[model samples]
Target: PDPTRAESKTVKTTCPYCGVGCGVLATLTDTPTGPQVTVKGDPDHPANKGRLCSKGSALAETLSLDGRLLHPTISGAQASWESALSQVASRFKQTIEAHGPDSVAFYVSGQLLTEDYYVANKLMKGFIGSANIDTNSRLCMASSVAGHKRAFGTDTVPGQYEDLEQADLIVLVGSNLAWCHPVLYQRIAAAKSARPAMKIINIDPRRTASSDLADLHLALTPGSDVALFNHLLTTIHEMGAVDSAFVAQHVDGFDAALSAASSGEVQATGLSANELAEFTRAWIGTEKVVTIYSQGVNQSTSGSDKVNAILNCHLATGRIGRPGMGPFSVTGQPNAMGGREVGGLANMMACHLDLENAGHRATVRDFWQAPTLPEAAGLKAVDMFRAVGDGRIKALWVMCTNPVVSMPEADRVKAAIANCDFVVVSDMYGDTDTAKLADIVLPATGWGEKTGTVTNSERCISRQRPFLPAPGTARHDWDVLAEVGRRMGWQAEFAYESPAEILREYATLSGLAAQHGKDFDISALSDLTEVEYDALPPQHWPLTKERRGGRFFADGRFFTPSGRANMLPLHHRAPAKPADATHPFILNTGRIRDQWHTMSRSGLAPRLNQHMAEPYLEIHPTDATTLGLQAADLAEVSSAHGRAILRVLLSDKVKPGAVFAPMHWTSQLSSAGRIDAVVAAEVDPVSGQPESKATPVAITKLPAR
Candidate 1:
């Protein structure tokens, strides 16, 4: 090999896995034969400061040509893009004509770029005039959105990551930050090291690795968050910690909320008075408290209520808008926040806009230049699957996510997809359980091979630039969708030459939002050329130059017409279906330290496999003893929805009536290890997020053979 003509270039990009959205520097090296790309953290990005977690670091390995969907595949054969697009459009048209707009649904994902999400949302909710489009975000942070809306009158994150460092008290509620959000955890850890007096609290049922950093750990029972938060409110009020002036000026319904919080019924939520008082006292004593929460709070049947219960305490004390004092929802995916910004969720319109308001709807319709728009909120995740299963939805298009392995009542989801008249799957890998059932498979660009932007948990937007050519015949998701749109008679709007162009248009859309008073406005980049877009640096939202480092609700002005927040009164409710005598154990599902969802990428790494390589149930030793079970004992867990078998690990981490299982593995990984198979489809009424955390089940020790 010769080194005379060697060259190199660096591309700024963002991580594609978790919501930390660490900025990446992709270096392409030119050799005598060919070019090779390598990745590392971008030092200037605020989220990570040049550091990356395992998933983001190993992203390059997963973008291989092996098992890649090379072309538009229909009925197990390769086809032209034109033919595939024509078939999809014609079929969708015929299906709508035969069964109605409700007969079809678009199931998209947070992994999609804001541009892709915007177009899909427009097509399904505007052109198609069907309120049946939803995204994988429903399974992640829909509850947080609902909670923010109820408490603040808008879906807004009021603080920046710097708040985590500046806080005197940091509370990790129902989140495993150490494992799931490693980069953010590192920041908190570094902050603690720098300021030894800063206190940390971990509030969760399981004593996870994240608890290692906690000064105090509240191992509260599952579904008891509302009570604990309510008790905190009562204590704050009694201690005179309430910001009376701020509350009076910017809030309403505090009396009813306070009355409900102080009621005796709160004690029945499995928290003792003493514990609640201690937690509340700590919160009141601290001037700056940042409470971070995730799926553990959002995956419950009363998920939205739990979110408000937490936010209510912050608002009552007027702890928001100031440094180190606010409610922070740590998102599960890298672009989950971006998805919301672009109105990717089923119930929302574009640019943090509302769907129900006639004016908001009219504005978005006019912005998109759409023919028509859906008049109401769309069907959510669970409802979309229910519609498909009931035959109300004739066709379904799923992108980026694997519902068959990840959704609640996933077996039924698989069955529904299999039975649907038409099912289209767009993915990077070809062999996922969901993709196997596709009537058509469109290969999508993976992390290092795609270019776009993703917003992290803190609302920071970072660019994702391709380091190398797309593997095999895999295409960018926006290109594929746009091609299909063109075939469907949407010519000019979908005619984009590059992701850079699409991003410029998306930025312009955000600019349009600025004229309408939405805080998510990104008008600062509306003038960027293609070269500038490709070379754009990482930045946070509310991207107008005037508001850099400014968190939301700083002026105590909410998005409601009254410009005031609402303290929604909430009542505690148990899981929709509690464990019974027949199915007597509560099953909790979650992620492990070193694995990604459904083992699509993480499973490819042998080193990543060392941590809990197999699926096993973590049951209390006492429960295992009563059930004649021991560590590594084969056991069968059965629920009303389905059944699965796994090895049992008797541990004290779980309560006697409760069990825990990691949600990453699938049926392909282990014959009987798919936990979602045994999970129920119960969902929160307000958030539409499934109750994956608490499912009733029965466990029996199986014979060794």
Candidate 2:
């Protein structure tokens, strides 16, 4: 073949980092040194239109096979695929036989492809007769899911990414968009530059890079989002901004919700009267406004209530599901939305169906020919690890995530996994903190070597086509799940040939769910052949023949039993654990700009690591001085749960009584930088999502070594 022709081989895929779902073009060429892959933004994709963030641009550098687990292993010895699969099937079967299905659990992750998530959910919930399957998404977007279901009768995002650019005003709550979601930030920044009159409001406890573009920044008290939004709701009512006709016709619980909002004290927001007046005026004045939230909103003890408070403001003013108005949730992981569609959450069934709904459960059971299905939700992330620690869950399967480092009370989580009766970890790297404690380790293909699909934060499903070959004995996660399912004696149900076949089955089931009035309907693509599936383009959901992908609830029609949105009567609640004299400072944890979770992939790139080399703590200058600490000094931060020593970076960004730390470092990367170990295990009552942002802790400068 001609050199030019050979070098022209390129595949259009999706970024494996954030939920922005930016399209990527991976081009392969043969060089004298070896095979080289170059990745760039795909200009044809709608999500980003050729905009790539630092992490996405450095994708090619992370594909090296260094330190990769090339084959399956059992008890630190290499094992054949057949042997590993048989052992996994046998142990899981024996565990269920002895302790019932609830005794075994599958802890999956958002890094998995849609196909992988679907198979894992099916095998655990259908074949295994239990709902004990949960994804790491439980730690990020579960609050949004719970709030959506309570309000709309289903988990549905109202608007798309375009709303951010089209809106007259944008309210960002608990999100560091510039560092966490760079491409979306770039889009909003560009839109504002073009239309200078557009307004932006940043509401966060700490001043962040995203605040640079804000016309106003509200650094309110931590865990006070409900109070802030409640104040806004009452202000809208007083200003006569309520859409009376819309509320009367298409909303429920308005009287009670408004009464609750009226009772909330504006002082709880920790904002001055002038700031409150200015914020409410802009929000009530702008008819086209979008409220975007992320982990900062979701990872809280009152996360669900906080979500409803924001939704209440949008609903009261009829500013939702329209072109430039709605409450939008930006997921932290690439496939968190896809996992939601496939019932990766313990409380859900496939395609936005409720596990507690008898009719919905029956429909899925009949479609899958399942022997039995659990009628109740299972253990969530925090509870799952608790069960493991207490010996209630005997067998555990961890796939594609490092719970040992990422989970709250992580030291206990690490100890639980280490002492569990049996543990199986499926990942690309075997030496990760979690994998080191596993009884069995299964090698799996990573981003560039996997072929599947993922749904982004905006509900767009994009294909992730492979541009390189699998490194060694590694296999796709979907393939591994299917093989295990077959070994578990569900041959016919699990006899999937390819990712295309799995997508077809999932889509067909989604059609059944749509028949039951669910919001997730992608049945139009169920008839695609292998070639058609392989060449599928990025598209939005609700892809039926009559209606293609776009916004939901735009026509004032919701999936609720009463056909009206429900505005919850929410009251402001404080964080679960309050700061005391011993631990007088609250600890906030989050992600950094360059590093991804646990740094399995992003850490491999030296350029990415250069952004912020070591794990450090962000503290206010006043707090640093009060604690007898100086910049670059090592500080020991301790909570009731655990402690860590981090380099101190004194800045006024953080409040005087609060400190912030990134959650990316692990035991493998740093000796004592696993921040989650210091996070409390408190969770929201409704959503079961851990409260990661406000753990009470105490800090002191470490002595010289």
What is the per-residue lDDT of model 1 for residues 1-705, given as tens digits with 9 covering 90 to 100? 557787999888888788988888888889778776677998999989999988777766665566677787898788876777788888888898888787889898888877677777767777777878888889999999999988776788899999999999999999999999999999999999999999999998888889899988887878888877887888888888899998999988799999998875566556566766667778999989999999889999999999999989888988898888999999998889988988888898778778887877877778667777777887899999988988989889999989999889989998999999899889987678998999888888887778777888888878877777877778887787777767767787678887667666667777776666676788777777887877777777777756654788889888777888888787777888878899999999998888988888778777778878899999999999999999988999989888889889878877789999988887789988889999998999989999999999999989999
If scored against the real structure, what TM-score would every candidate get? 0.97, 0.99
User: What tens-digit string does per-residue lDDT give for candidate 2 at 417-441?
Assistant: 9999999999999999999999999
Deviation in angstroms for 671 in model 1? 1.8
Instruction: Pick out the ten consecutive residues of candidate 1 with the lowest summed lDDT.
Output: 264-273
Give me the runs in candidate 1 sitting further than 4 Å from their true place: 1-7, 30-37
Among all windows of ten consecutive residues in candidate 2, which has the lowest summed lDDT? 1-10
Could you tell me the TM-score of candidate 1?
0.97
Residue 440 error, candidate 1, Å: 0.6
* Candidate 2: segments with Cα more than 4 A from true spot: 2-6
